[model samples]
Target: IRLRPGYFPFVEPGFELDIHCLICGGKGCSVCKYSGWVELLPCGLVHPNVLRYGNIDPDKWSGFAFGLGLNRLVMMRYGINDIRHFLSGDVRFLYQF
Candidate 1:
């Protein structure tokens, strides 16, 4: 896992969560796009404006958020190549689980 600076609209300070490529074991590979990292999610502190919109006071509260890409997670976890297999309305693939 690696933590680096990032940015997102909804958060004041943002971050990206990338895991060491399971396929490459931290080595550069096609699966990791030769960067050796698989981007999985994004996180950050809640923006004050966003918090205000939710009826929360920025001065009184602070928090962080993470956006998980389920598709990516599934692909990484199962080593899936074609995203269609997961999004396809076909039940055949679901049966594998």
Candidate 2:
């Protein structure tokens, strides 16, 4: 996994998390854009403005946020070639998971 700088309106310090491509085992693949890495998460410390908006003391408290790319994770785990399969209403593919 790797962490790289990122941006989000609600977060002050954000990072993008990436993992080695499972489909090609870090060699290369279209899924990874031939970079051998697949983004897994976007996470960061909560911005002070967000905390203040929630009536929390930004100076006295801090928080963080993260979102998991479940579909991507599953795709990497199962070597699925297309992400649309998850959105497709086909039980034939959905049942496998």
Candidate 3:
């Protein structure tokens, strides 16, 4: 529903956020993998001390992050016979979608 810039240890800069799909109106949808939403990205500001600790300038650096659930969405879209098919390398099933 909202996105905010922040920081994380693993990433120089991090962001936390939530998104609603216009197509689904926040309801479950094939496009959203029945989760009713999609991830935009996780991005944030680089800590001045963190950049300096890494020997990089805080002023010149920035970053962002996000994740996708590709397989889940595919299943929802096609009504696949099984989730295993996605990784099973079956051409027949893949073509239908």
Q: Clashes in each model (backbone N, CA, C under 3 Å)?
A: 0, 0, 5
With candidate 2 superimposed using the best TM-score fit, by how many Å does residue 66's alpha carbon deviate from the native?
1.0
lDDT winner, 2 or 3? 2
- Candidate 2's TM-score: 0.84
lDDT (Cα atoms) of all candidates against the true structure: 0.82, 0.92, 0.61
Candidate 3: list runs displaced more than 4 Å.
4-7, 10-14, 22-24, 29-35, 57-97
List residue ranges in candidate 2 displaced over 4 A.
Answer: none
Candidate 1 residues 1-97, lDDT tens each?
Answer: 8888787899978889899877667787766778888778899999999989999999999998998877866766788756678778789889877
Ranking by lDDT: 2, 1, 3
Best by TM-score: 2
Clashing residue pairs for model 2: none
Top-lDDT candidate index:
2
Clashing pairs in 3: 14-43, 14-44, 15-42, 15-43, 42-65
Predicted candidate 3 versus true structure: per-residue lDDT over 1-97, tens digit per residue: 7766655665655666657754566787655567766555555554577667888876887544355445545554555434578788879976876
